[model samples]
Target: MHSKIFRGIQQEDVQVAADALIAEGLRPTIERVRQKIGRGSPNTVSPMLDNWFAGLSKRLGVANASDEQRLQPPEPVQAAAAMLWQAAMQLAKHAAQEEFLQENQKLDMRRAELQNHEAELISRQEAFNARQIALDETLQLARDQLTAMTSRLEEAGILQARRDREIEELRQQLKSREDERDAELQRRNDDATRHADERLRLEARATANEHRWLTELDRERLEVKRVVSAHIELESRAQATQTQLKTAQAALLDRLNQAERSLKDEHHAHELAKMHILELQSSLDVCRLAYAEIIKSQASQEPKNSRRKPLKQLMRGVTVRRKL
Candidate 1:
C-alpha cells in the first residue's frame, strides 16, 4: 500500500503507453496516455508523451533511409500516398482539437477549485488574526494581575517584619522591668533582716541592765532596815542607865547623836538609789517606745512574713518591766 500511494508515472512508463497506443492506431495524446496507464496527471504525461513522439520520428527517418535503396514509387502509388497523407493529417487535426477542448475544460475546473481554496484561506487568515488579538489581550491582563499581586505580597512582608521587630522590643522592655523589680525586692529583704538582728541585740542589752538595777535596789532596802534596828537598840540601853552613872551617861548621849546622824545618811542614800532606779526605768520605756516605732515602720514596708517574733518578744519584756 505504501508503494502504491507514492508511485508516479516515469518517462519510461509514458513511452511504453504511447508506443502501445500507436500499435493500436490511436493518437497518444495526454488524455489517451493517462487513460492507457489508468493513472497520471496531464502535466506529467504531456512532456513525456511529446518526448516519445520526437524519438519515434527519428526512428522512422532511420527506417526510411534504408527504404530509399529499395525503389521509387509509381504515379498511382504516389497519388494514393498523397490522399492517405491528407486523411492522416485530418485525423491528427481532429484528435488535437478534441485533446485541446479536454485540456481547456480541465484548466477551467482547476481554476474554479483554486478560487474556492483562496476564499477558504482568506476566511481562515481573518479568524487566525482575531484569535491572536484576543490571546494578546488575555496575556496582558494576566501580566497586570501578576504585578498587582507581587506588590501586595511585598507590602505584606514589610508589615510582618515591622510587627516582629515591635514585638521583640516589647519583650526586651518587659524583661528589664522584671529584673529591676527582682533586685529591689532582694535589697529590701536584706535590709529588713539586718534591722531585725540589730533590734534583737539592743533588747538583749537593755534587759541585762534592767536586771542589774533591780538587784542593786533590793540590796539598798536591806541596808536601810538594818540601820533602823541598830538605832532602836541603842535608845533602849541609854534609858535603862539614866540615874545610876552620870559620866558614863554623857558618853552614851554622844554616841546616840552619832547613831542618829548615821541613820540620816542611810535615808539620803536610800532616796538617791530610788531616784536612780526611776531614771533607769524611764530610759527603758523610751527605748521600748522607739523600738516599737521602728518595728511599726518596718512592718509597713515589709511583707506579712517578715521577722515579727523578735518584736513580740520585746513588747512582752517591756510589759513585764512596767509591772515590775
Candidate 2:
C-alpha cells in the first residue's frame, strides 16, 4: 500500500512556499501548501497550512492556532513566535481535549449498549436455568411415581402369590374333609351289613324270644338313623367349604382386575409425564437455538462495528503523525 513519495520537501520548504503564497497575497490553504510542497496527505499539509496562516496572523500581532508548525522562528521574530506558539499549543490542546471528550462520550454509549446486552443475556440465562430446574424436578417426580407404581406392582404380585397359596391350602383341607366323609360312609356300610346278618341269624334261630328280636331291630333302625344324620352333616360341611372356595376365587379375581386397572392407570400417567417432558425439551431446544442465533448475530456484527474509520485512515497513512 505504498504511495509515490515527493522528494526534497524539508522544514524550510513549507515556510518558503507559504511565504511565497503570502507574497502573492493568497491564503495558504493545504491545496496551496500541496501545490508548493508537491507531496503530502491533506492531513499532513492542512495543519501546516493552519500554522503558516496562524503565524502570519501573529506576525501581524494576532494570537492562537489549533495546529503546530515545521517553520523555524527567526531571531527577530523569536519572542513574538514563542507567544504565538504557546497560544497555538493551547488552542491545539483545547481542540484535542474536545475530541477526546467526544470520543469518550461515544465509548460510554457503546459500553452502555454492551451492558444492556449483557443484562438481557443474563436475564435469559436465569430464565433458562429456572426452566431447566423445573423440568428436572418434574422428571424426578415422574421417576418417583414410576418407582411407586413398580412397588405397587410388586406388592400386587406378592398378594396374588398369597392368594394362590391360600386357595391351595383350602383345596387340601377340602380333600381331607372328603376323605373323612368317604371313610365314615364305608364304616356305615359295614355296620349295616353286620346288622343285616345279625337279624337274619336271629330270625332263623329264635321262634321263642320275639320280644328280644323286636328290641334288636329297633336298635339297628336307630343306629342307621344316626349314620344318615352324620352323612347329612358331612355333606353340609362340604357345601359350605365349596361356597367359601368360590367366594375366595371371586375375591382373588376381583383383586387381579383391580391390580390390572391400577397398572393401566399408572401406565397412562407415565405416558402423560413422558409427553410433558418431551414438550418441555422441545421448548428448551427452541429457546437454545434462538439464543444461539442471537449470540451468533451479535458476534458477527461486533467486528464490523469495531473497525473504526479514523483507525483505518491512520493505518493507511492518510493522516499525519506527531514527531515525538
Q: What would the per-residue lDDT of candidate 2 be over residues 158-239, giving only the tens digit for each residue?
A: 6556655655665576567557656766775676577886766666454444456457557755655665565566556555
Question: Which segments of model 2 are wrong by more than 4 Å?
Answer: 1-102, 189-318, 321-324
> Candidate 1: which stretches are off by over 4 Å?
1-94, 194-324
Model 1: how large is the Cα RMSD against the reference? 64.1
Model 1 Cα lDDT, one tens digit per residue, 131-164: 5555556555555655555565566556556655
Please tell me which predicted candidate would have the highest lDDT against the true structure.
Answer: 1
The local distance difference test score of each candidate is 0.57, 0.55
**Candidates' TM-scores?**
0.32, 0.34
Error of 2 at 153 (Å): 2.7
Candidate 2: residue 260 lDDT (0-100): 55
